[model samples]
Structures are given as structure tokens and as C-alpha cells.
Target: NKQGRRQSTISLSTGSGEPISLSMPASGERRLAFMDLLLKHHINGGELSEEDIREEVDTFMFEGHDTTAMAMSWIIYLLGHNMEVQDRLALEVDSLFDDLHSEMRNESNSSSTTEITLDAIKQLKYLDCVVKEGLRLCPSVPLIGRSATEDMTISGHVVPAGTVIYCFIYQLHRDPEIFPDPEVFNPDRFLPENSGGRHPFAFVPFSAGPRNCIGQKFALAELKIVLARLIRHYRFVSLDQP
Candidate 1:
């Protein structure tokens, strides 16, 4: 707890109140609150080592902001180009709850009690498809680079140990065989019937395997909430100047 407060104080002082003026969410506060709870319950007697806490906090901020911002920009661009898909998405958003008044009441009730559930999100299949397809088209990070720990052979090509390998997610996603008319912005491609037979790695906007993103659920939830609210309020139209 002291360490967290110290870090926040240092950040504030070093920036001459610029960081505080930015008024970003106090991630420092969240960490401190969690640590306080742990101490109160005797779950953790000692503080997290400074290095460990800093690394974890850095990782969280990088992944949280970068990935979601990129995904949102791509989704909005996709919607701008594909009016039909955007219209369908707007309709789905509109039909999700009974009406605006009912939805407001439900939101208030839900806020007071339980957090939004995965089940509620699952019901909005169309919105999900839009997000998934947008991710496929413009993955936030286009390529994933990894180094081989040991020598490996694939398709008669031997990769020497310590060789750096680049997996081109963007190219893989646009492969004609995997995605018919790959250039088109068609969210229906993510529909169960269409996506079922595809190789799992064929559509890895969040990547695959154990190291895959841990915040995929959080990102999806944020997208759904934002899209639902935006579509219900004002319609989007591309500016002529652009």
C-alpha cells in the first residue's frame, strides 16, 4: 500500500501536476485498494516487489489502451465502408432491450447489483460478429514475432534454434481459401455456420495458444456497451471533408 502511494506521489511530483491534470483513471488507486484488501484479510503479508508490480502495471496499461483503441478505430472504419453491415448492427443494438426507457432502468438496476454477465453479451450475436470480423480485418498488431527456443522443421524447412519467426496474422486472415472475397467487410463470415469449419488459427485476431490475450472478454464487453449506446443514440455518417 505504501509502495503504491509512493509511486503515485512520485508520478505526480515528477510531472509537476501534469499527470494529475490528465486525470486518467487512477490505476494506482485500484492497485492500492486491492493490496489493502489483501492485507486486511492477511492474504499477503509482504508487499509486491517494486519491479514485479511495475512490470505488471506497465503490461496492463499497454495492452488495455493500445489493443482496445486500435480495435475500435478499425471497427468504426469497417462500419463506414459497409453500410449494410452497419445497418444490421444498428438494428441488432436497437432490438436487444425492450426500449430506451426500459434499458435505462435495467442499466441502473444492474449497476446497483450484479455486473453485466457473459450471457447477456452472448445474446447480442450480431454485435459480436461485427467485432470479431473487424478484428480479423485489421488486427491491432499485424504480426507476432517469436524466437524459437530449439531447432524445428516444418514443411521440410528447418528453422535453426534462436531464429526469429514472424507470424503474419493480417495475411493469414486475408487468405482467399480461408475467407472468401477476403477484402469484403462481411461480419456474417464470423457466424457459426460459416466459421465452424475453419482452422482455429485462421482467425486469430487475439492470437492463439496459452499466451493469448487475457483481456479479450473485457475488450468485447467494452465494445458491446459502447456500440449499443452509440447506435441507440445517434447514427454515424462519414464526413464529406474526409
Candidate 2:
């Protein structure tokens, strides 16, 4: 609602026979950053108490680190299970490293150590696809829920206001219509050409929209660096392998 005024809200039946309406005070003004909003403005009726702020900060730290770590571990597991994919990733990253080193060696100060800068990591296009595909197969946060502040229709289904919408991101990622052979670990699924005409929301590994994961870019970069370095140095073998 706006200014504490009751807005037309919907009640969602949570399968427990109880209809519940979830509401939060409408944002008055947009701030430059989330921290600015958190620190400056009063949201959801009034200013968030110190305890609320601390909880928010703690949630971010815990969720961000845990989700990224799990996603990276899942990616490593996928690579281990698929030797051909692992080999391909290694080959791609090796080529990228070779190019980067060659370019660095060409510098006048050839003694400068070659390091994986952000720009250098971005050059690994194949690795990016691999990461995206891995996320699609195994999303860290499998579910997300949002409430409808207003009445809306989705796919011809009328969703009343105040209705809680629970999205199963894991199922969405594996939707056969959106991703053919969705269960397969095929990095090519995310290739620019291959992914053309796909629904943007088909992949929600880190959720999406206004409340999407704030550290998604940082997490992806970290995952790429860790995976690239590890793959370049060692070949991972699955436990199932004799």
C-alpha cells in the first residue's frame, strides 16, 4: 500500500486452508543504492529497527556466500560427472590462458607476472556458457515466492490480488519446452546462437527481477576464476570411476 493506505490486495490459499495476505509499505522514493534505502528511508510502515538492519546484513552475508559456494560445488560435480565436458572446458580455458600469457609476454616489461584480471576472465566465453549451463542444471536456490500486490493474469489464469506465488526455479530451469534435453549437461545450450529466442526467465538460478541476487555477478566471476584455475591445473575424476 502507499502512505499506509490499504491497497487492493489478494489472499492466497496456502493449502493449509488458511488464506493469507502479505503486504509491505510501498517504497516512497528510489534511492541511489540498496544500502542507502536501508539506512535512510522508512520502509514497510516505519523505519526498520536496528535488529532488522542487522538481520538483513547477516542474511545477505550468509545467503550470498552459501549459495555461491554450493553453486560452485555443483558445477565441479557436473564437470566431474562429465569427463568430455571437463576436457572441453580445460581446452577452452587453456587456450584463453595461452592467449593472455602471449599478450603479456609481448609487453615491454615482460617480467610482469600474468594475472587473471576481470577483463581477461571475460574473454572466456565458453567458460561463461559452462557456468550458465551448470546453474541451469543445479540452481542454488531452488524456490522463490512473491506476493501479488494487485490482481494479475498469468497464462490465462486469473491470480487475485494478495495471492502468494511460489515459483519453483528448479523446475523452470528444466522445462523441456524451454530447454530441450534439459537434464543433460550441455554447455552449448547457453551458446549465443543456441540460446536465441529462449525465454529470459527460463533460467532463474539466482532468481530474477527487482529482488534478484545482488552478488550474482561477483559470484559468477569468483566461480569462473576458481573453476578455470582448478581445471587448468588438475583433471577432476568422478568417484564412480574405477
Candidate 3:
């Protein structure tokens, strides 16, 4: 190994002699793991301790796992019932398939996310809308609470400082004034032309403002890549009574 660094390998395979496909870093570049980054800060940056690393890792696992899994489940459900929507998305996903090999995946901005190229994921316009619509219909956290720092008036009502404001995302998403026929699983609502006029805070699946969820972009990237792969490989249909 270069610079007296020993390389190691761990294999999870049977000796059946089947070829394996995995994307790798460029010829001379080495990849860094998430923990490696944390360890680097722990040692060099001196900002993260061993305990801090452990807690951050735990938070990453806990926050990123179940909620993303649940979002995928709900998106799958929506795709199943909405065959036309799924078909359109499938066409979009398929158009990008030629550019992305079936086994194609490479690390993006974060290792704790799906490995598909960020550029490829960005090309998934319909899938992006689908995920947003899915989250709107089935947000992981149905409600969020925030405290008002200053007195303000909303809807012609007065509010005082230090007041706890509970926003019911479940109900907010279903408001017909904001989203026409909100109950319908419509991804078009997120299209740029249609969404341009919507208020920034109109959609708050991951909360909003400075105190928002730190992992919002990470979670969205993860969900999009995973869903892209799944939809490319399988066609889902609802089994429920029509």
C-alpha cells in the first residue's frame, strides 16, 4: 500500500465464481466512510469526542431509517393505486436507465445515503415530485410544534410571545385552499409552473426555518435514489378492493 498504509478487504460471498458489480472511486482516489469523517474531526478537528461520534451515529441511524422506510412504503402505496401516475414515473425512470446501469451506484455528498450518482438522481424530475407528493399525503411527522419568540398576528388574530404553536401538518396538507383536491395523490402540484405561486412555508414536511431538521436534504436524497432503483426494477399494483 502507498504511504505504508495497509489495505484490507472483507468479502460477503460464496466461492461460486459469479462476477460482482460495484462502483468505486477514481483510480488514485480513496473513498472516505462517514465514521472516518467523524473520526477525523474527533482527532484533527477536536470538535467531536468519542461519545459525540457515538451519539451522532445513533441519531443518524435512528432518524434516517424508519421514517425513510415509511416514506417509501407510502410512495409505493400511492404508486400502486395510481397506475397512471406510476406509469408516467416509470417512463421517466426508464428514460434515465440507459444512462445509469442497473448496478450503477456511486457515493454522493454523504455516504449514509443511497449510492446512486447525485447527477442521475437529479434527473429524476417525476420521481422528485412523486416523493414530495407522497410526503405531503403521508408525512413521517404528522405534526410539529414551535414556540413564538415574538408577538404576531395571523389570520387577523393576535398571538403573544412564548406561545407554543402546534402546526397540524396532516390537516395543513389537506387544505383545499392551498392544494386543490388535496386528497388526490397528485405529484403535479409540485411542478415548477404550478408550485411557483405556493408559499415557501406551504409545504413543511421537514419543517422550516433555521431550526428545521438538519438531515432534510440527506433524507430526501436517500429516499429518491432508493425509490428510483426500486421503481426501475418493479411494477407495484394495489391488491385492495376497487
Evaluated with TM-score, which candidate comes out highest? 2
Question: Tens-digit lDDT track for model 2 on 1-242?
Answer: 25653332334344487955433334554433654445443344446664565566556666867788888898999898999989998998889888778877787547555677788789888899999998998888889999999999999999999999999988888889888898899999988999998887888887889999888889899999888889888988889866
Candidate 1 local accuracy as lDDT?
A: 0.71
Q: By TM-score, rank the candidates, best first.
A: 2, 1, 3
User: lDDT: which is higher, 1 or 3?
Assistant: 3
Question: How does each model score on lDDT?
Answer: 0.71, 0.79, 0.79
Model 3 agreement with the true structure over 57-81: per-residue lDDT tens digits: 6566657787888888999999999
Worst 10 residues of 2 by lDDT: 5-14
Better of 1 and 2 by lDDT: 2
Candidate 2 lDDT for residue 16: 88
Off by over 4 Å in 1: 1-31, 34-51, 99-118, 240-242
Q: Which stretches of candidate 2 lie over 4 Å from their true place?
A: 1-48, 108-112, 153-158
lDDT over C-alpha atoms for residue 158 of model 3: 94
TM-score of each: 0.73, 0.75, 0.69
